[model samples]
Target chain A: MTTKPWDLKQCIKNYSAKGIHGITIWRNVLEGQNLRDARTMLDDYNMEVVSVARGGFFPSVEEKKRQAAMDDNLWAINQAFLVRAPVLVLVCGADGRQPLEKSREQIKEGIIRILPEAKAAGVKLAIEPLHPMYAGDRSAINTLAQANQMAEEINSDFVGVAVDVYHLWWDNNLQQEILRCGKNGNLLAFHVCDWNVPTKDFLNDRGLMGDGCIDVPQIRGWVEDAGFSGYNEVEIFSHKYWATEQKEYLEKIKNAYLKFT
Target chain B: MTTKPWDLKQCIKNYSAKGIHGITIWRNVLEGQNLRDARTMLDDYNMEVVSVARGGFFPSVEEKKRQAAMDDNLWAINQAFLVRAPVLVLVCGADGRQPLEKSREQIKEGIIRILPEAKAAGVKLAIEPLHPMYAGDRSAINTLAQANQMAEEINSDFVGVAVDVYHLWWDNNLQQEILRCGKNGNLLAFHVCDWNVPTKDFLNDRGLMGDGCIDVPQIRGWVEDAGFSGYNEVEIFSHKYWATEQKEYLEKIKNAYLKFT
Candidate 1:
C-alpha cells in the first residue's frame, strides 16, 4: 500500500521511470480498470507483470461463504490470466470461528479445487505463508515449513510457495525450508519488506528494507543460494509510507533494495 | 494485567477470595514491596506462588546492557526465592540492532550464566517463548519447538519451557512440541490467554480464555495427556479489562476459566 495515492496507470508510469521493472497488482488496483488496458499499460511502461497480489481466502465456517470464496478465487485466476501474469499469490486464509487445523485443511482443499483451472488458464498459484501475527484472520499457513508441507503434498506443477522476508525472516528453519522449497522446484517468488521493531500495528506499519530488524541481504543470499533467481517483489503495507509522496518513497525503496537486498 | 487495579497485598487477597489459589507475580507488582512480607501476605491469603512473572532480556547490542541484564536476572532469581515461588518465567529478549541469530545466541548464554543461581535458589527457569510479533524486541525464542530445543540442549532439570497459549496458539506444530517438552520433562508452566480476532494492539490487547479463537480446553487436554498436571495459569494483559472494575473482571475470569479451561 506504499503508493496508495497512485492509480494503476500512474503507479506503472512512475515505477518504470524509477527503474522498478516488476509490478504485482493487488485485486483492489484492478477494480474498475479494464484488464486489457491494464496489461497494455504495463507493456507501455516496459514493466513485467509479477504475480497478482492475491487469490485465496479459502476457509469459512459457513458453507455458503466457502462457496462464495471459491467463486471469487475462480474470478481472480481469470484476472491473473487477463493481466498476463504467470502466478497468483495465495494468502491461504483462516477462519477464526473454527479450529486452525480445519481452516488449514480447507486451504488445501481450495487450492486443489483451483489447480486444474489455474493450469488450464496458464497461471501458477504461489502459496504465501504469512507471519504468525496474521494467522488469527489473514492466513492459516504461518510458516515456510507448513507451506512446503502443503505444496509437497499437492505435488502439482501449477502450485508453489512465495517467500516473503517480512513474514519468514524470524524463523530459525528459514534457510533449510527455503532449500527444501527450491529442491522441490516450488519456490516461485521472493517478496522483500521489513518488520519494524515495536511494530505499532499488525496489518500496516511495515518498514522499508534496511529500517527494521530483518537481515534482508542475508535472507536474499539464502534465497539466491537455493536457486531462486526471481524478482524481489516489494510487498510493503505501510500507512506511514503511503502518506508520503509516492515518487520520493519509490526512490527510498530503490536505495533500500540496493543497500539491503 | 487484569489485576492492574490491585497492589500485591490486595491482589493476593482478592485472588484467594475468588478461589484463585495459584498466582504468578510479575516483578512490577513487587517493585517497592518487601519480599518477606510478600510471602507472609500470600500465606495469610492461602495463595500458592506459581511463578515470578519474568526475568530475561538477555540480548543487547551493547555489552554493558547485557551485563546489567544478567545482574537483574540474578536479582530476580532472589525475588522468586523470597516469594517462595518455584519458577521464574523468562521472556528471552532480542536486540533490533543485531541479527536475530545473534540475539538467540545471547539468550542461550544468558540462561547458562543464570543457571547456577537459579539452581542454588531452588527455582526452575521457565523459558516463555513469546509470539513471533515479539521476536522483534521482546524474545528471540518465539516457538515451543525453539524453547523445547533450548531446554533439551541445556540438559538441566532447572531449565524448562512455559507454554503460553496467547503466544503459541497459531503454531501448526504446537501439540507435537508440547508433547516433546512433556516427554522430556521440560514442561514447567501452562499460561492461558486468547488471541482476539483482530488483535488490535501488539503488546496489550490480550483476551480472556474463552473470549477468542484459542481452544483452551483442547490445549489443556494435550498438556494433561502429555502428563503435565500443573496449574493452568491465567495471564491476561488487556488495557480494556484493566480499565474495568477488577472485582467484576475477576469474576469474569473465573467464569471463563471454568467454562473454557
Candidate 2:
C-alpha cells in the first residue's frame, strides 16, 4: 500500500479514524494474516474494503510460470472473496521475452482461465490498464480502449476495468472511453493520484492529487459523468510521502482529495 | 542527439564516416553556427540531413511565451530550409498551468499559425507525438491517433507525423494508425530506439536497438508495409551511452541498427 508504515490493521484503524471509510487492500499486506480476521477488522472499523490491490501478473513466456501466475491469482481471488472485497484489481503483465502482442494474448487467455473461479467467488476482476511507461514488463494493456476491447470480447459481467486517473489521465480519449466503459457496465472501480511533472521513479513516485500537473478534478468530473459513483481511492505511490510521517501524509491525502478531486 | 558529446560538425563527420549518412539536427547544436556554413559542412561530408530535431513548444500559460515559441518555430523552419532538411519535427508542448485539452488546443493552433511559414520554406512540419509520460509538461500529443487527427484537421501538404518507436511501440493501435498515417500521406519520418526494460531515467535512459525489449524490426516492417521507405533513425537518448566515447558509440549504433532494425 502507499502507506508503507501501516500494516493491514493499522491501515483500517488509521483510515477509518481519519474518516476515510473505504480502503483498498494490497495483496502484499494480506500476507501472514487470517482472511476472516481481516474481514472482521474491516467490519469492526465500519470501513469498506473497496478492492483487493492486485491479482494478475498473467503474461510470461514460460508455461510453468504462467500456470503459477494463474494459481497465485486463484489464491488472490480466494483472499478477495474471504476479505469481502468486491473487486480484484489486475495489473496485467507483459513479457520482455516475447512480442507485446503475444503478451496481450497471454493476458486475455490468463484472465479467461481464471474467470470462472472469480465468477464463482462473486469478485469482479477489474483490469487496471497501466501507463505505457510500464509496457516493457508491467503490463501489455496500456490503454483504456484496449482494455475495453478485451473486456467486451470476454463479455463477462465479472470482468471489468479499474480507471486510475494516474494512468488514464494522459489519454485524450479517456472521457470517451470512460463513457463506453460505463455504458457497458464495465467501470468497476476508480483510483485517484497525480502525475508529477518530473516523475522521478516509474513505479513509486506518484503525487498526491494537487501536488502535480494532472487535472484531477476535471478527470473526476468525466468519471462521474460516466456514472461511476464509487470510491476515489487515494492511490499515491510516493516515495516522498511514504518516507514522511504517514499520519501527516494521510492528512495531506484527505485535504488533497477534498480540495482537488 | 543521443550522442550528447558530439557537436553538429563532428556528428556529420563521424556519422557519415561510419556510413550513417542520415542525421537529425537538434536546434541547440545550431545556436552559434552560421546556417550556410553548417549546410556546407554537411554537404562536404556527403551527409543527408533528414530533419531538424524540433520546432514546437507551443503551449504556455503566458501569451508572450506562446509568441516566442512561434518565433522559435519560424527560426526552426528557416533552419530546416537553410540546412536543406525536408522535415522539422515538432514536440508540441504542454503547459502545466492549464488542462491538457487546452495544451492540445494550443498545439493545434500553434501548428496552424506556423503553416504558412513552413509552406513558404518548403519544409514539412512533422508532429512528433511524445510518450504519455511526457504528457504532463512536454507534449500534449502523445499518440499517433492524436497526431493524425491534428494533421488531418490542419489539412496541409506541409504537415505530417513523425513515428518514433520509443514513444509509440506500446500502443496496440500503433499498426492500424501507421496504416492510416501512410494512407493519409502523413508519415514523414521514422525513428527507432529500444525501451530499456528497467528504464532508469524517464528522459535519457533509452537503450540501443537490440539491448532492450522493443521489437524494432517488426515495427520497421510495419512502417515499410505502410508504404514508408525512409531511414530508420537511431534516436537513443541514453546517459549511459552518451558518457562513453562517442566514436565507439557510433559503432554500437551501427551494429544495433543493422541487427535490430
- Candidate 1: count the clashes: 2
Candidate 2: tens digits of C-alpha lDDT, residues B144-182 = 999999999999999999999999989888999999999
List the global CA lDDT of all models.
0.92, 0.91
For each candidate, what TM-score against the reference?
Answer: 0.98, 0.97
The count of backbone overlaps in candidate 2 is 0
Tell me the tens digit of each residue's lDDT in model 1 across A1-261.
458788999999999898788888888999999999998989888889888978999999999989998999999999999998999999999989899899999999999998989999999999999999988799999999999999999999999999999899889999999999998899999999998987898888999998899999888889998998889988888999999888999999999888887
Q: List the residue pairs that clash in candidate 1.
A: B1-B236, B1-B237
Kindly report which residue stretches of model 2 are placed more than 4 angstroms away from their true locations once superposed: none
Task: For residues B25-56, write the lDDT of model 1, one tens digit per residue.
Answer: 99999999998889888988889999997899
**Candidate 2 DockQ score?**
0.79
